[model samples]
Structure formats: C-alpha cells, structure tokens
Target: MIDYKPVSTPMSPKPKLSLTSGTLFDDPSKYRMVLGSLQYLSFTRPDIAYAVNKMSQFMHRPTDMHWQDAKQILRYLARTLSHGIYLRPNAPLALHAYSDADWTGDSDDMVSTNAYLIYLGSAPVSWSSKKQRGVACSSTEAEYRAVANTTAELRWLTSLLTELGVRLPTSPVVYCDNVGATYLCANLVFHSRMKHIALDYHFIREQVQSGELRVEHVSTKD
Candidate 1:
C-alpha cells in the first residue's frame, strides 16, 4: 500500500463493513499485524479512532473489505503526514468532555458507537470511540449510555488530578447532544424505560447529585 493513491478520508461517510458482508481473509496473522500497528497510531490520531475501532472488530477473521478500510487510513496518513495532535502548555486546567453516540450504527449487530473527547481548556487530552456492549432500545438510550461511559472517564481523571495536586475550581463539565439523555441524568426518577440499564451506569447520576460532575446539553452541530 506504500505507493497506493492517497484518499481524502480514512472512512466513507456511509460504510458497508459488516460481519457477513465480505469474503474471509486468507491470512489472519498478517491482518492482525497491520491492525495492531494502526491501533497504536490511534493513540495520537483521534480522527482515525472510529475507523480503527471498526476494523479491529474483525481481527479474528478479517476480510478483503477490512483490508480496504485499513489501507484507506494509510492513504489518509500519507496525504497528511504533517498533521498530528498538538497540546498547548498555556491551556487552562479545567476539564471538559464532549460525548456523542451513533445509535444503531453497526450494520451487523445494531450496536451503538459511543465516543468522547476530553479537553483541558482548548486542547484535547484524551478521547475514545467504541461500540456499546449491548443494543440500545432508543437513540436516547444510546446517548445515555455514552454519558455513563464519559462520566466514568471523568471520575478517573478527577482522581488523577487530585493525586497530582491540581485543583479544579468547579465540577467537571460533560457536554452531550441528546436532550433526553441530559434530562435523564439531571432527574432522579427511574422510569420504566431506564430499568433495563445496569445499576453501575447509574453512577453518573450519583456524581451529578454529589456535585462531582455537571452534565449539559449541547447542539449536535457544535
């Protein structure tokens, strides 16, 4: 793929990858090797997190379509080798996280993809994109699950900051695009729709009530 023509993006706006859609790859070991390398690259290239995570789901039995997706990432990297994450030393210490989810985006399993970006002032410090553990009943449910996951990450970051003697002036703010999810977090009422979710994910509400985190609604376009 070294001399392949460069593409504009790492993934298509409408991807067709699925467990049953493509022919099985003949060499599983080679596919895993390349996938592993890309996974490491994702530590700094948050732009490719969704593509990398999508392809990784097929590591056990990669197909030609999977290899095609991997090559697209390489082509994207080749076209923009000079671009990478930059952190600013002068950025504020206040932690803010933006979280979103693609409801039932997976073609095969119908699982939602949860994503979050953690920023210190204007600079991003951590981010993640992963498929959810189970199927969500509604778009709101998917978004709520993403909030739960982001809240867990915020808890860890808060602990780490405390250990480093860094003081946060106020509760860490979490921004989500889904109004229903934000309302669910802010309200204590356990509706029938929310009973299916595990008790552990409810920690986000506890943190909100205890003043450890603040969940807010943001526009999806932002």
Candidate 2:
C-alpha cells in the first residue's frame, strides 16, 4: 500500500494475535512473501519482534487477519523509517542478558513465548523471540525455561569473546522478572515439584557456582 496511512503501533493491544483469529487469506503465497521480507527487516528493528513472531506462527496457513497485521507493521515501518539501532564503537566490553516470557500466550496452543536480549556493554548484540518447545505447567516453569535459553546464549557469547582474547569487565549477569525463576537459578533448593526440570536446574546451577553467569531478579517495569 504505497499510499496507506501510517500507524503508530505494529500490533493492537486489545486483541493479541492468534492462529484462529480470522478467515484464511485467498492467496497464502503472497502473505508468505511479505512476511518473509518483514522477518528480514526485524534483524535491526526489534520493536516489531513480538508481533513478527506471532505472525510467523501462521505462515503455513495465513488468514486475512494475518495479512492485515502485516500491513499494520508496514505502516509502522513507514512511520519510523529513520529509526534504527546504532551500536557505539567505544562501548564497554561487558556482557548482560535480560529474559522474559509470556505464559501460555498462544490461544490455539498452551505454549509460552520466551524472549531474551543480550547486550555487550551498552548496545544489544543478540536477541531471540521464540515459542517454547513444550507446554509449561506453571508461569514459573515457563520463566525458568526462558532463563535457560538466555543462559545458553550467554555461555556462547562468553566462549566467543574468550577465543578473541577479549576479557569482559565482569561476569555476565542475567536478569529475569520472575521471582520464582530467579530463585531457582540462584538458590540450591531442590523441591520435588522441580524434578521435571532437573536438567535445566543443574545446567544453570553449574554456571552460577563456577562463576560463568549470575541470575538476578529485576522489576518488570525496568
């Protein structure tokens, strides 16, 4: 839509994206092509990540509503053509990660969405927005899984930097908003209910004890 009016937001806050939200689009190929382009654009524009992840779920069988959302994202991109992420050359040489999850946010499935952002000093270096592989029994379980994903990324970054002969200013710290998940990572408590996630528990605990990473809680508002 060359002349389409620009929108302020990529997605509507009232109704979140769902696979069964609307009727099937007439031409799914066209929808796939547009969505593919948008996915490529998200490499630099993280603001549309959540919305893009939602739309990506319907790529196999996109509907008219999905197409509408894609158009809305286009409008948003149009409105902010000049906006871009700029990494500074003189930023500090430290690593930090922030992770968050939406518990069972999918309407069609009970799966959660896990998202994380990794920063080297002051600028973002890596980030992810993906649906969890399995259903979580509780919000804490979902949040904890997100932490594991972020921690894995942290380790990779650490090893890469070390190979380059780069020493970080401090140990990498991971921040999560869920108190229960944060405690699970930092504390040595082993409850019966946590047995299902024993592998994740051991993985993170090993990192904490070895001083490879640190997990802490942060206010959601932060």
Candidate 3:
C-alpha cells in the first residue's frame, strides 16, 4: 500500500482544484507515458484518481483530444503537488467514511461513478473513485451501491489494522448523504423499488444490522 502524507494543522492553504480540464497533445506514445506517471502519482494524490483514471481509459488509441485531458491533470498537479493527507497530532483518531454516487454520470454506458471519502481522525486515509457494477433503477439504489463498495473497503482496512496489532478504537462510521438509501439499508425490505440492485448488496445491510458499520445520514457538503 502507498503511504500518503497526512496534514493536520492548516499549513499554507489547501491547494485549489485546477480548472483546466484538457488541452492538445500531438504524440500518442508520450501521452501514454505521461498518463502512466500520473497514475503512479495518484498514490499520494487520491483527489485526482478519478479524473486520471477516466483519462487513462483512452490510452490505446489516444486522440489529440485525450492528450489534452492528460495535460490538464498535470496542470492540476502543478497547482497541488504539495498537498496530501493531513494527520494532526494529539487529536482523536477515529475511522469515518462518506459515500456518494453520480447516477448515470456517464452518458454512454449510463453507469454511475461510485466514490467514497474516508477519514482517519481529522485526516483522510482512504478513498476510492470507481464505476458501479450495474444499471441502478433509482438514485437511492445508486447511492446504496456506493455505500456497499465503501463498506468493503472499510472491512479490509480494519482487518489489516488488526493483523498489524493496531487496535481500532471504535466501529467505523459510514455517512451517506441520501436518506432514502439509509432507510433501504435499515428496513431490510425487498420490493420492486430495489429489484434491479444486485443480491450481493445485502452485504451492506448485514453489516449495518450486525454493527460492523454504522450508517448515518450526513449533509452532502461534508
């Protein structure tokens, strides 16, 4: 696993997300090489993981259009290379996670972008940005899918901590912005409303019921 630098007290300032999306690059091979570098850099810069991963999908036959997007990530990195996870001293260390989904975010496949942000105490340690497995019938289902994915990540991390002899202080807290999904998780109800969701998703409901992961509704901005 990559060890990302953690920040606690505010240093200079949080680096702003670079606004440049993409530009024009002529060499297809160089474009592929640059993409490789950015993907490795994502070990320290998780915020850009989604954007960089999206750009890498076009590498085999990268167009001038694809090259522009790769450069855009470089520009964003240029503006925020100094940033990483900020872990403060003497603060309470707790594991908390937040999940969200962009329903049908992709116009082509109509797949949702399932992502989560996880904080170890005041600093974030783990996060993921990935495409969901199937077409969700509703926004609630999409968000629930994201929560299930994030729950798996939490379970794996906690297991690693236990193997390393690190005692976890509390049950991991998982916050989702959608309330209806929260109900879906707790109610244990089966209905046409959720028929499209895969059967494996019940894993989240089980974890929630057994108290391995606590699901709570939080403000979307958090």
Best candidate according to TM-score: 2
Candidate 3 Cα outliers beyond 4 Å, as residue runs: 1-26, 190-192
Indicate the TM-score of model 3: 0.81
lDDT per residue (tens digit) for residues 33-99 in model 3:
8889887887777778777766666676676666655666666666665788777886575788989
- Give the CA lDDT, 0 to 100, for residue 144 in model 3: 91
Off by over 4 Å in 2: 198-201
Residue 61 of model 3 has an lDDT of: 65
Query: Order of candidates by TM-score, top first?
Result: 2, 1, 3
Each model's C-alpha lDDT? 0.88, 0.88, 0.75
Instruction: Show the colliding residue pairs in model 3.
Output: 6-85, 6-86, 6-87, 7-85, 7-86, 7-87, 22-68, 23-68
- Model 1 regions more than 4 Å off: 190-192
Q: Each candidate: RMSD to true structure? A: 1.7, 1.5, 6.8
TM-score of each: 0.92, 0.94, 0.81
Point out the higher-scoring one by lDDT: 2 or 3. Answer: 2
